[model samples]
Target: MKTCFIVCPIGNEGSETRKNSDTVLKHIIQPVCQELHFQVIRVDQIYGTDRIDNTIYEHLKTADLIIADMSEYNPNAFYEIGYRHALGKPLIPIMKEGTDIPFDLASLRTITYATDNLDKASAAKERLAETINSFDFSIEQNEKENEPVHQNITPYLLKIQDEIEDLKGIMLKRNDEFAKQTVELAIEQIQKNTAAPENKFAEILMKEIANDPKKFKEFDAIFKNLS
Candidate 1:
């Protein structure tokens, strides 16, 4: 079964914030997820000896769906939401009605709920269900490819890498050409200044280069790795 990871604030137990979270989980999220056959997992439900933060990160990356509650302006929740967005995965952002969404995330379609009113809670649940149902979660479909990171930043980074590779190749070729020309010029100058037999100095220098290939290889390597 597909998993839906919940990213939300978990205030201290028995506090009003905690009670609101419980109601949303029990009434707003779990019911709809259950009907859709999604296995819902939350940070509080996680159990094991593993570091909790690491475990939460793994879920944020690998979960098939994510429902991030923006209520309370919780820093942790917002950070996780940012992390999830960077992965270009499915994310459903929700918040309590009247809560102001940050400007950066104002463009996202966030489901607003009012747990104090039964009718609004019911409506929010329906909206959440509809949003979940609208996603094309088939094995062959990737509905979350439209995330901003994937749409813009990933391609930009890849393009930069490609350009860097191309530049390295050009620099290496130019370095090799320059080295060859410099050696040829030096050989020409030596032969002219020394009164050696015609082309004799060139032949001796070429023979020395052939015999000590490692020296030329080291020289080339130094240039290759420059910057």
Candidate 2:
């Protein structure tokens, strides 16, 4: 099935932007996507401790289209949208009227609407759906035409690199200390666990560590000690 990734806020319901986005997703976006033969996947639904980032990354990589609500400039939403941009996927950027888009994305096309009016929101949804269905909306073509002259690293990759770099720094900082010995043990355990043939839990834990630098470092000593 053709899939579309929809990015919006999750836990915070007090924000007007979040409420309007929820309405658009439930009342308009979902139905229109269904009619257009597209499966709508929301970011908020994919939560938990195990493989969440990996799952979300896989979805973004494979989705036919992405609809990002930048009204609140949510961090996760921004990260997902940026990843889509790097993957050269078809993306529909929407925001509440009067909000200024970041300068970096100002050149890209975006749809803005006033959320207070139900009519405006509905019209915006219809227009967005129509835009997605149009034959001229080719993500591959757009990416090729606007391709950067130099190689640009994706935010996802950059994040992973940053985490690895942080780990390296932590190792250096702990060198010649008792903490170093502790970290060495944790790494040994992690390697064994990751090397195991059927340790899905261990794999999940590794991915979680890869995603969060602070958490990974705090427990790095303990994890390394494991066998």
Candidate 3:
């Protein structure tokens, strides 16, 4: 799960750029990134809770790639791009149709597309995906290859990230299991006392859960407190 440090201006809901950004995210960025196995993180998603400067810098230093939106010639976006460049991180610079690329960065690779056209946005996504796939990571790999300290710790950090994703999936599965068990438990409790006729399907479900209570253990702690 490689990280993509997204540098863009987060505008209010009514702003045109915000609308455009949403289009870019849905039609361009998300689909392409999902294919490349990159987790997208932007300042809006994880910033301001900490010292703003430090939070952005930490992500810039660690993310595997940066996809910078230079759409507005935004000072903050450029500042982040400068910091990323200084760290020698890989980046893909993208901008709206009319935005200027800085003279100094004129020689660097960039993607420019129409924000007003969904068709063009889709085309640009394929181009951006191709550009990302073609990037040479040999420089970063070679440097890590020579460092014994980095070789050991880098793997540890990656494993921790992988485990975090796994735990998220496990937590979701348990939550779903608990909800199903609670529904069955409620059905059983009602059937135990109420004069109302049981729904045959629900009775079958309660019987199934009773026969396999171990699978319903996630609800035990919460259900135990009930009368």
Candidate 4:
């Protein structure tokens, strides 16, 4: 069966946004894939992380196409989608109504639907199914044959699989350290000022930083001092 990557958000049960998005995705997306004999691989279900992990990269390398929901402009979602675009993979970018499509992706084709209404979701699903059915794998093969060799990046792509694994290991350890320090700092701050809101704010900020390493480095000095 042909494989497709389905990128979307997954969070705790309390997260209404993720819940609603998953509901529509399972209801509309999976049925279409079944009919077309395509396998649907949801990144979250496979990797158990919101960000693109090594498993996700491996899946993308094999996927015939990617169906990405950019409804929330989620940072990780955008990152994964961008990676797919870089690989020249066929992509279907979809969003909920009223969400501003990012400027960088504005030139590409996309589908917008109203998640609040089932009718709109159904219409969008039908359109996407038709689009998927119309894909010609022969074109993909021909394009690959006609593509020029990129000597510079070809070596990097060859090593990317191993590099990504090493990076994930480093990131997991770094995030653990950050989380431990964050909790200690929050407790210390609370002890200094029993009624202060700073600790609560710090907790929120630290959680965000733990989720994204790029932001963590921005406050490297602070974290170093805390160490």
Model 2 residue 19 CA deviation in Å:
2.9
Clashing pairs in 1: none
Judged by whole-model lDDT over C-alpha atoms, candidate 3 comes out at 0.66
Error of 2 at 210 (Å): 63
Off by over 4 Å in 4: 47-52, 139-227
Candidate 4 TM-score versus the reference:
0.57
lDDT of each: 0.74, 0.64, 0.66, 0.65
- Order of quality (lDDT): 1, 3, 4, 2
TM for every model, in the order presented, reads 0.62, 0.54, 0.58, 0.57
| Worst 10-residue lDDT window, candidate 1 | 151-160
Candidate 4's residue-wise lDDT over 5-53, tens digit each? 8876666766987786787677777888788888888765674545557
Model 1 Cα shift for residue 43 (angstroms): 0.7
At residue 44, candidate 2 shows an lDDT of 66
Best by lDDT: 1
Q: Relative to the unseen true structure, what is the C-alpha lDDT of residue 183 in candidate 2, on a scale of 0 to 100?
A: 41
> Could you give candidate 3's per-residue lDDT for residues 63-178 as a string of tens digits?
87888888888898899988776655577788887788798666456677786787888768876886677555444532242342122222222223333343435545566564
Q: Look at candidate 2 and give me any clashing residue pairs.
A: 185-224, 185-225, 186-223, 186-224, 186-225, 187-224, 189-226
lDDT of 2: 0.64
Window of ten residues with lowest summed lDDT in model 4: 149-158
- For TM-score, the strongest prediction is 1
Stretches of candidate 3 exceeding 4 Å from the true structure: 137-227
